[model samples]
Target: MQTLSELGLAVAQRRRALGMTQIDVAKRAGVASDTLSRFELGKATDFGARKLLAVLAVLGMEMQYSLEGHAGSLESLAREHGLRR
Candidate 1:
């Protein structure tokens, strides 16, 4: 499992790669600039899923779970077992 600090670093790297400022992401995600700043600084302890998703969306990314070195689609596997919609 990735630590929150690692995830925050990933988010910051992605945003920087896209030349996006914290205020830009805040505007796009409808969050406060300070909130996004805290997220990027790894100071946020309890990030809400929807807010995190919004932030990822602004950075042109989506959250997913996967096993290490797996090539198969998790969604497909889940559907095969009727595990998720």
Candidate 2:
């Protein structure tokens, strides 16, 4: 997603879809449950890349990168094309 908040929401959705608990994921990812909770709530300000990768790994997810203009906020993309949400 284009923003940390969006990413957090996506992670929460994925975790729920997999029937996983925040505590379980935190334990498996080697991070504190509080940290995981903050992250899932889009309230984490200092979550490092390594920890993020670890969490993603535990969730069977991976990050993907694309050229700058190829991927952006859905709202921005829609606006650019004069489309409605």
Q: How accurate is candidate 1 locally (lDDT)?
A: 0.85
- Top candidate on TM-score is 2
**Count of clashes, each model:** 0, 0
Quality of model 2 by C-alpha lDDT: 0.88
Q: Indicate the TM-score of model 2.
A: 0.79
Task: Report, for every candidate in turn, its global Cα lDDT versus the true structure.
Answer: 0.85, 0.88
lDDT of 1 by residue, 21-42 (tens): 9899989998888888888788
| Model 1 regions lying over 4 Å from their true place | 67-85
Q: What RMSD does each model have against the real structure?
A: 7.5, 4.4
Extract clashing residue pairs from model 2.
none
TM-score of each: 0.73, 0.79
